[model samples]
Structure formats: C-alpha cells, structure tokens
Target: MHASDTVDEQLELAADLPPWEKLASKARALKVMEEANKIIEDFPTWEYWVFFLLFMTEFFLAVYVSINLLK
Candidate 1:
C-alpha cells in the first residue's frame, strides 16, 4: 500500500530465486537455438544469396572504375 511495502515485496521475490536459475535460463536459450536450426534446415531459401551477389558485383565495379580514373 505504501512505498516501503512495495519495496519489501520486490526484495522478497528476488531473494526467493533458486541458485540454478541462471543455468536453467541458458538451457532454455539453447533449446530455442536448436529449434531455429531445425526450421532453417527444413525450408531454406536463396533470395538472400541473389541480392548479396548483386550488391558485391556493383561494389567491385565502382571500386574498379575509381581506381582506373586515378591512374
């Protein structure tokens, strides 16, 4: 009801945590990564590769033209 009461509740909750909470959180995160890998393996796409190749080609052409102009 008061500011001190709210602070006491928060402190109590924090103190009641199990010692292995951090380890358990990391395990849950690893499980999520494993699931993501499975999904990506099942449905791989290649539009990203096409865009990447186009970007690199344009970048190299620009660099080549600039170097030839300086020489």
Candidate 2:
C-alpha cells in the first residue's frame, strides 16, 4: 500500500530473478516461440470463426433495432 513497501517488494523480486540477458537469450527465445506456436496450432479455429459470426449477427441486429427505434 505504501511506496516504501512497493520498492522493497520490487527489490526482493529483482534479487530473485536471473540476469536479463540470460532470460532473453537467443536459444531461449526460439524455444519459447516454438512452444507458443504449438499451443496456438492446437486451438480450435473453426469454433473461433463460429463465435465471430454469431457475435457479428447479434451486433448488426442490435444496430438495426436501435436505428428503427430512433426513426
């Protein structure tokens, strides 16, 4: 809640972390990207598109109702 408490917590966290360069190393970055791609590849893309189309339909219907009511 206080500034000093926040600074102390951040300092403790910084002490616990590895160096920034090691965290952002090239091999690590590539491995992280590969894992991320695998996760994304496993997603159900058709379900996403189905929800998108449903949302658009509802949105347009709401807009049409509002316009007719205003007129």
Candidate 3:
C-alpha cells in the first residue's frame, strides 16, 4: 500500500533471483517449444469453431461502424 513497503518487497525479490542467462538451459527451451508446437498442431475442430465465432463478431462490429460513419 505504501511506497516503502513496495520498495522493500522488490529489493527482497531481486536479492533471490539468479542472473537471466543462467535461468533456463538451451535444451530446456527447445523442449518447451517442441511441446507447444505439438499441442498447436493437434487442435480439435471445436476449437476452430470458437475462433470462427470470435472472428465473426469482429467482422460484424467493423461493418456496423462503417455503416454508422457513412450516415
């Protein structure tokens, strides 16, 4: 809530973390990306349906705005 409390918490956090380069290994990074790609490639049709609905909403919104501005 107060400034001093925020500063103290941040200092405590900074003291505990390792340097960025030492965090995750190159092999671990590759493994994570490979797993993510597999998940994306295997998506079901139902998920595509959701994406279609979201896109249709945006398309309709654009059409509505264009018509109103022309008026």
Question: Which candidate number would show the highest TM-score if scored against the true structure?
Answer: 1
Best by lDDT: 2
Compose the digit string of candidate 2's lDDT tens values, residues 1-71: 23223333444545655777434443454565567778889987998999999999999999999999999
Q: What is the lDDT of residue 5 in candidate 2?
A: 39
Q: Assess each prediction's global lDDT (C-alpha) against the native.
A: 0.64, 0.65, 0.62
RMSD of 2: 11.4
Where in model 3 is the C-alpha error above 4 Å? 1-44
Write down the worst ten-residue block by lDDT for model 3.
Answer: 1-10
State the lDDT of candidate 1 residue by residue for 1-71, as single tens digits: 22223333444544556757544544555566667678878774698788889999999999999999999
Model 1 poorest 10 in a row by lDDT: 1-10
- Residue 17, candidate 3: Cα error in Å is 77
TM-score of each: 0.42, 0.41, 0.38
